[model samples]
Target: MKLFLVRGTAKGTLVPRSALCEPRAPHFLHEPPARVEFLNGTGAVVPCVVHGSPPPRVTWTTRAGQPLHEVPGLRHMRPDGSLVLPPFRAEDFKEDVHSAVYRCLGTNSLGTIGSHDVRVRAGERLGTLSV
Candidate 1:
């Protein structure tokens, strides 16, 4: 008898792998938090947890379905199940943050899972700023 490994991707189709080749494991959501906080001057930070026979490749995207670019202000964790936002600046809030959205992506040899949409906003002040 002989054993074979099958691999798959979002595009479709599966291929066989040699015994030496590492098999792709299914990426599962382990401890992904439902909601997170966006600090007053700090950007949003969401934690992602995943486990499987093989670790998963993690990435992030905006709610609007935009890919997160590798920049100073924005950042993400690799195979680990963690995320970070370097630092938030005024320009990051200049945009329409009211409609901003955040999401977590996890992909492994087996499959992938994404977190729910995370909305970011500026904290409210009790008293109004008077001139």
Candidate 2:
């Protein structure tokens, strides 16, 4: 009787060949951000978590389809998949253009997934009353 053995292509490696396979599509851990609010001159953060076999890359974009990083000092994407919005200035409140919707996108070798629309509202600060 003859015996057959299955060996991995690489030598001296304990990792199974299947472990190097491509990852599955990304999925959300929970419902993506639907809306977020912030006061003028205050920073804002929106969290977007995702799960996948090999991990996915996270990115942010505005509702108008503009990349978040291209917004100069206003927007930044954190390593933990959170979008950061720097404090707004008085000039930003004049046109109301700063209050816009955003979306988080996760992509891997398998496919891409987009989070729900997140409306960011930067409300004006109320004045204090003094006697």
Candidate 3:
């Protein structure tokens, strides 16, 4: 089993176990897209990326704690270390679109890491209204 030490919480911080530290489990980080553009009538396209060490797994999920694959209209693609969305349905888009919470999860044989939530929106261009 892999060993992990979580930090940065309200519970305060803990000292690093330098005596028992090991470098077997490579560090992992996610490179999720900072922004996503939702065009008119086409669908939403979200790109999830991963950074840091290799051999990682990436997936998405909803704020309701529902698995992404279980959610409709959400398509996931695994290519290299990027998650591609061919297209999303209008109906499904309604669920995760506009102020909805979508999370990108990355995992490796050693541990798992997730990126900041990517908010989906329905608009044309930044600061432009869709009519």
Candidate 4:
């Protein structure tokens, strides 16, 4: 596509190649694995890396399409758009919270795209030593 940089009422003629930028659909740089296994209390990090010409907004949701907001100290989303399930105490482990499927939605003016389902599983940490 041709791009013209007009100045005021003056007509633009030559445009630099570097000025050639276009809006495009969001593309995932890297997505979370199908399943993630983490030691209980250690938690996990589910990444949803994505990018587009105009940049995109990121959001996490359940399999049923419910908005998954951060649960105080339990979970949070990083500035880089990665979901962080912070480490927790063994007694605070919740089956529903520790093990579930999540979807990452990346949206921009062009459109929105969703990452594949990411299922996280938490395992009990027996003793300090891991086999």
> lDDT: which candidate is best?
4
In model 3, the clashing pairs are: none
Please give the ranking of all candidate structures by lDDT, highest first, separated by commas.
4, 2, 1, 3
Q: Give model 3 RMSD, 1 decimal.
A: 10.9
How well is each residue in 1-131 modelled by candidate 4, as lDDT tens digits? 75466544455556654454678789899876878778766778888898987899988898788888888877788978888888887787776667788889899999999988888767676453223
Query: What is the Å distance of residue 59 in model 2 from its true position?
Result: 0.9
Residues 1-86, model 2: lDDT tens digits: 43334556556445545554546798988545687777667867788987786798888777876777645566777898988777
Candidate achieving the largest TM-score:
4
TM-score of 4: 0.78
How far out, in Å, is residue 74 in model 3? 5.6
How many collisions between residues are there in candidate 4?
0
Q: Write the per-residue lDDT of candidate 3 for residues 72-123, one digit (tens) a residue.
A: 4445545654444445433444445444667777676677777666665554
Candidate 4 error regions (>4 Å): 1-20, 126-131
Candidates ranked by TM-score: 4, 2, 1, 3
lDDT of 3: 0.54
Instruction: Tell me the lDDT of candidate 1.
Output: 0.56
Ten contiguous residues minimizing lDDT sum, candidate 3: 19-28
